[model samples]
Target: MEYSIEDVAAARSLQFAKYMYTSMATFWTYDYACSLHEEWTFLLRSHWSKMKGLYIATRYLPFILLITNLYMSFTPNENLVKCGMLVNITSGLGMILAICADCFFIIRTYVFWNKNKILLAAIVGTYLSFVVASVSIIVDTTASAAYATIPIPDITGCYQSSTSDQIFIPFVLFSVFGLGLMILTLIRAIHSWQRNQSHLYVVLMNHNILYYACVFLFSVMNIFTSLLLQDSYQTVLDGVQFLALAIIATRMHIHLWQTNQHLRGSSGLVHIRLSDMSSVNVTA
Candidate 1:
C-alpha cells in the first residue's frame, strides 16, 4: 500500500517526538545518578535506620526503572508485550517510593506533634486509605498490557497499556497528602515560633515546606499530563516526572539527616565556670 504525503509527515513527527522524549529521560536519569553518587557515602555509612533504608530504596528503585524503561524504549517491537510488564514493574516501584517518601514527612509531622498517639493514628488511617485506593487502581491497570505502534521499525516505546483512565488517581492522592502535611507543619511551626522563637524550628519549617512544594508540583504536573494529554507521549513524560520526584525526595532525606548531625554537634558543646580564681572554660 502507498501512503500519502500527510501520513509520511505525521509518522516523521511522531518519530521525532519519541526521540525527544527519550533524550530528556536520559538527561534527567544522568542527573539523578550524579546525585546518588554525591550522597553515596552518607547513604552507605550512616547509622542503619529505617529512614535511611527507605531513602536508599527511593533513590535506587526509580533509577533501575529508568534504565529498564529506556532499554525497552530502544528494543524491538517483538518484545513490546514484555515492555508492558516492565511498565507495571516501574509503576509498582514508583508507588513504593512515593509511599516511602511520604512516610518520611509523616514521621516528621508526628515528631512535630510531640508523638501524639491520637494524631498519629488519625494520620496513619488516612494515609492507609489513600494507599489502598491507589494500589487498587495500580493493580487493575497493570493486570493487562497494552501496546502502541512505533512510527519507526524496531523501537519499543510504551503505550498507555492500562485500559483504565484513572491512572492519575495515585498522583492526586500524593498531592493531597503533601498539601495536608505542609499545612499541619506550617501551623505547628507558627505556633512553636510564637511560643519560643527557636532557630531550629525556623530551619525545620523552611526545609519541610520547600520539600513539600517541590514534590507537590511534580505530582500535579504528572496528573495534568496523564489526564489531559493521554494520547500523546505521556508515558515517557510521566516516567521522567516519577524519576524526578524520587530524586528530590531522596535528596531531602539526606539533607535532613546532615542538618540534624550539624545541629547535634553544635548542641554538644559544654560551658564550665570556676568560682575560685578567674577562669571560664567552654568546650564542644
Candidate 2:
C-alpha cells in the first residue's frame, strides 16, 4: 500500500508536533527544577497575598498539566474515548491556567497604572467577555469534535485529531484580546518611564514588555498552527505561550519582591504603597 503525499505530510506534521510538545515540556520541567530554590525561599515561606493563588497556579500547575499531556501524546491509541477525554481535560485546564496568567498580568498592569478604576473596569470588562466567549467556543468545539485515529502511519494520536475548524475561533479571539492588553500596557509604560526613570520603574517596564512580547509571538504562532497545520494536535503552542508567560511574569514578581525587601520602605514594585505590601508578596 502506497501512501499519498498528503498522508505522509499529515503523519510527519503530527510527529513533529509531538516532538515539539515533548521538548517544551522538558524545557519547562528543567526550568521548574532550577527555580525550586526561589520558589521555596520567596513564594513558599512568604506570607500570602491576594495574588498568591494566581502566582501558584501560574507557577506550578503546569507541571501537572504537562505530565498529563505527555501521557496523552505517548499513550497507545487503543481507546479513542479515553484519548478524547484526556485531550479535552488538558485543553480546558490549559486554557484556565492561561486565563489565570492573563488575570495575573491584569493585576500587575492595574497596579502599575496606580489602580486606575477606569482602566481596570475597561480592561477587566473586555477580558471577562473574552473569557466567556473563549470558554464557550472551546467547549462547543471539543464536544463536537470528530475524534479519529488518523489512518496515516506514524500518527498514533489520542484524539490527536483534526478538530472542527471552528476551533480556531478561540485562538483568534485570544490573539485579539492579548493585542488590546498590549496596547494599554505600552501607552502607560511609556508615560511611566518618562515621568520617573527610577531603577525599579525601569525594571517593572522591562518585565512587562517581556510578557507582552512573549504573548504576541506565541499568540500569533498559536493562531497560525490552529488554522493551517494539519496535525495541530493539542492546539500546539498555546501551552508554550502560557509557560513562557508564567516563567517571565512569576520571575518578575519574585525579583520585585526581593527588590522591595532590599529597599526597606519604598513601594517601587508597581508603585503600590500600602503597609501590607511591605511584608507580603503581592506583586502579581
Candidate 3:
C-alpha cells in the first residue's frame, strides 16, 4: 500500500530518533573509554590508595552508561527496554564518584588535622550522610515502571530511556559536599601557612579548590540542563560535563606535582640560608 504524508512524517521522526541515539552511543563510548584508560594507567603506576580505587570505579561508569544507551539505540523490543532502564540506573556511578572523592578529602583533612577531633568527625559524618542519600535514590528510581514504559513507534527496534530520573538528592548532596569540603580545606591551608609557611599547603589547597569547584559547577550545570532541556540535548550535555570534569581533575593533578617540586626547591634555599646564618654567628 502507498504511504501518505503523515506516514512519511512518522518515519522521519523515528529515523531522527535513531540517529540521535547513534550519536550518543558514539560520543559516550569514546569519552568513557579514554577515562577508563587514564584511570587504569594511574592506578597501575601510582602507589596503592583509596583515591585510586575511586578513580578506577569512576572510570568504568561512563562505559556502562554508554552500553545502556547503546541498547536503547539498537533495541526495539518493549520488554527489554526495562533492562535498558536498569542500565541507565547505573549512571549513578557519577554520583558515587563524587561521594568517594569527598570521603577521600575528609580522610585527608583528618590526617592533616590530626590534633582536631571535632572537625574530622564532622567531615566524615557529612560524607556518610551523602552516601546514604545517594544510594536511596539509585535504588528507588531504577526499579520503577516510569523508566521502562516510554512508548516507541514500533515493536521491532531498540528502545532506551534517554536519561536518568530527576534524582535531585544526589546532585544536592554532592554540591553541598564539594562546597563544604572546599571551605574547610581553605581554612586548614590558611592555618598551615600561618604556622609554618609550608608551601605544600598552598599547592594542595589550590588543587583541592579547583578540583571540587569543577565538580560543583559541572554537577549544577548537568542538573539544570538535564532537568530543563530536551532529552536529545541531555546526551550532549552529559558528554560535555564529563569532559570538563576530566580536564579539571587532570590539570589539577599536574599543577599539584609541579607546585610540590617548586616548593622543594624553595625549601632547600631556606635551609642553606639558615646554615649560613649559623656559621656566621659561630665565627663572630
Candidate 4:
C-alpha cells in the first residue's frame, strides 16, 4: 500500500495530537495522586519559604502551560499560529519553570555547603547571567522572525512557523547549570561522608545526583532531538521534558520535607538547614 503526502501529514498531525493529550492526562493523574497522598497536607501547610514558594510555582506552572498548549493544539485558530503571543508566553513560562527548578538545586547546594554566603552569591550571579542571556535570545528571535501558521488539516490545529534552533541556546545553558550543580552536590556529599561517615549524607548525595542527572539528560536530549530531527515529534518531546522537569522538582521538594519530618519525629530534633551543613539532617 502507498500513502500520499497528505496522508502522511495527517498521520503525523494525528500522532502529535494523541501524544499531547496523553501527556496532559498523565500530568493530571500524577498531580491528583500526589494530592491524595498523606504528604499533601504537609506540602500545603509547610512554612512558605522562598524555596518553598518557588517549588509551588514550579508545580503549578507546567499544568497551566500544558492546558494552554492543549487548547492551542485543538482550537483551529489560524491567527493563533501567526500571533507569536502564544509562542512567547509558552517560552517564557518554560524559562520560569527552568529557573525555579535550578533555584531549588542552587539552594540545596548552598545548604550542603553550610550556607556559605560567598558561594551563594556566586551561584546566584551565574544564574542571573544565564537568565539575561536566555531572555535576550528569546526577545531577539521573536522580534525578528515573521511567524506564520502551518495548518494541519487532519487535526484541525496549527503550529507556529519557527525553527528548532531557538531551543538550543537556552537548553545548553540549562544543561551546563545542571551539570555544575550536580558536581557541586557530589563534592559536598563526598566531603561530608568522609568527615562523618553518615548514611544520611549518602542518601542526600545519591538523591541530588540522580535528580540532577535525569534532568540534565532530558535537557541534552531535547537539544539533540530538536537539532537532529527537526520534526513535529520534537514538539512532543519538548512538552514531555517540560512536564518532567516540573514533576521531578516538585517531587524532590516534597520528598525532602517528608524526610525531614520523619527525622524530626524519630530523633526529637531537626538539624537540617536549607542553607547550612551542620549535620546529617536533610536536603530536598
Q: lDDT by residue for model 1 over 1-284, one digit each (tens)?
A: 67566444434534544675577667766776776665876756576656667777776776576676666555554566676787677677767767766776677677677677898899899999989999998788777546655454443455543356788898898789778888988888877675644444455567678768866887888788778664335566666666666766767666655654565577744221111101212232
Worst 10 residues of 2 by lDDT: 273-282
- By summed lDDT, the worst window of 10 consecutive residues in model 4 runs over 274-283
Clash pairs for candidate 1: none
Clashing residue pairs found in predicted model 4: 114-277
Between prediction 3 and prediction 4, the one with superior TM-score is 4
The TM-score values for the models, in the order shown, are 0.79, 0.85, 0.63, 0.84
TM-score order, best first, reads: 2, 4, 1, 3
Runs in model 1 deviating more than 4 A are 1-38, 161-163, 267-284
lDDT of each: 0.66, 0.70, 0.53, 0.68
Cα lDDT tens digits, model 2, 134-208, are 888878877777665656655665644456666666767777877777777788877756666666656666666
On the 0 to 100 scale, the lDDT of residue 199 in model 4 is 40
Q: List pairs with backbone clashes in candidate 3.
A: 75-157, 75-158, 75-159, 76-157, 76-158
lDDT of 3 by residue, 54-136 (tens): 54454455565555555554565456655545345535644544444454345555555643679767777877777787777
Pick by lDDT: which candidate is best?
Answer: 2
Task: Report how far off residue 107 is in candidate 1 (Å).
Answer: 0.8
Give the distance in Å from residue 241's predicted Cα in candidate 3 to where it truly belongs.
4.2
Model 1, position 249, has a per-residue lDDT of: 70
